[model samples]
Target: MAKVNGKYETIFIVNPNLGEEAIAAIVEKFKTLIEKNGTVESVDDWGKRRMAYEINDLREGYYTLIQFESAPTFPAELDRIYKITDGVMRSIIISRD
Candidate 1:
């Protein structure tokens, strides 16, 4: 039988150069988006941290991690949004189930 829902964890790096307000807005945007489509288990804000390597010539990024349970199709849609959103330097979503 097919699974109706699955557990997922996603982490994304935001460009810290955007400043505090913009960064907060971006984080809030994704939280609301996930809540609309799924049940959020937890959210962890790692704050600004140095990356293992430079990206776009920047060395630090704001890190956020979210764990949730949602329909199997939701992660792909979420990934699409991340790819298009500004200030999202990197992102990855993994199935936990």
Candidate 2:
């Protein structure tokens, strides 16, 4: 039988250069998006931190982690949004189930 839902954990790095308000907006955007599509288990904002390697000349980024349970197909749509969003430096979504 097909799984109706799956637990997922996603971590995304936002470009810190956008400043606090922009950063918060980005975080809120994703939080709402997730909440609309799933049951959010937790949202962890790790705040600004230096990266291990430079990405597009950036050395630091604001990080956020989200844990949720949703239909198995939702992560793909979430990932696509992350890739297209301007301030998102990087993102990864993993199935916890």
Candidate 3:
């Protein structure tokens, strides 16, 4: 099937142990990754917060939300990158349109 552009939001949690510079680099990396294939509408940095439960032995995480518009095919690549990146603890991408 042919792909169509759509609105999507991605929320990712990064390991809180990373330093400030490392955290910023991760955010910037994903921002540019999306901007390369889509138009980014907004980026909301939730900063570090206590998680309801521990993940990988960590009780806190840095949360970030990105809302963007991209082709249907693009999120798969985004997900792939997220998985391979070392400090990302979890992530989810949802279609908003």
Candidate 4:
């Protein structure tokens, strides 16, 4: 089968209630997941930041940005993972290519 790899950027916010250790673990989990399914180019941890609006009655979150190259079909799986994770507050995946 042919690989249809494309560049993608994902920005996700995790609940601020989580401890630093837990937050780091979550970031690592996603990094590994992306690297395993694709190629991780960069990971930028923006740390905690104020949200523009409230979500789940929370006003702040830990932000992370990951740039990667992956097969076209892989994003849906990533999105699904993000949705099911307990601490994730919001996320977005966009094609950079």
Candidate 5:
């Protein structure tokens, strides 16, 4: 677990069409990236869900959360990848205490 000080909480939506293997691959990819010099405190599969809005015409998505300790710049890199990933419908990251 990360310390009681501030960290990051991120929720990235995966394309619902992606199966377990693909999803695992994607998760591993991000896990490696985010925790390169730090540690992942928690990960949660929020499961498949319906998006409140449309994204690439995808209405339903697989939601997951990753809490980690890292530099502030890390979230920017995460956002960049999320923007271009074909398997991600949407993503959001926030600071957590």
Candidate 6:
């Protein structure tokens, strides 16, 4: 498939400490927000797994994969929001092209 020049794919890792419902809610919120302004190719949850290293003292986390279409400039804003989110251990957004 042809991806727009400004489009991107974002994959963020959420903390595993959140209950199942909370995890679901967070993922759904992301799906809703991303789909509202752009296109979402997929949203995948890899479940809990051990991390390579500790993050905020966390050794494991709920691994989630998200593939969405977005503008070039949108990632920074998204990153900023994710950085402040409590249950988000770490998040990174990369261009899918």
Candidate with top TM-score is 4
lDDT of 4 by residue, 3-30 (tens): 7899999999999899998899999999
Model 3: pairs clashing at backbone N, Cα or C within 3 Å: none
Clash number for each model: 0, 0, 0, 0, 0, 0
Model 2 per-residue lDDT tens digits across residues 15-71: 999999999999999999999999999999999999999999999999999999999
- Candidate order, TM-score descending: 4, 1, 2, 3, 6, 5
Give the residue spans of candidate 6 off by over 4 A.
1-5
**What are the clashing pairs of model 6?**
none
Residue range with the least summed lDDT across 10 consecutive positions in model 4: 1-10
TM-score of each candidate?
Answer: 0.96, 0.96, 0.95, 0.97, 0.83, 0.85
Best by lDDT: 1
Cα lDDT of model 6 by residue, 16-45, tens digit: 788899988887877787777677888888
* lDDT by residue (tens digit), candidate 3, 2-68: 6779999999999988999999999999999999999999999999999999999999999999999
Query: Better model by TM-score, 2 or 4?
Result: 4
- TM-score-better candidate, 1 vs 6: 1
Candidate lDDT scores, in order, read 0.97, 0.96, 0.96, 0.96, 0.83, 0.79
What is the per-residue lDDT of model 5 for residues 1-97, given as tens digits with 9 covering 90 to 100? 6444349988998887889889878877888888784679999988888989988888888889999987766778788988888797778989885
lDDT (0-100) at residue 48 of candidate 2? 94
Clashing pairs in 5: none
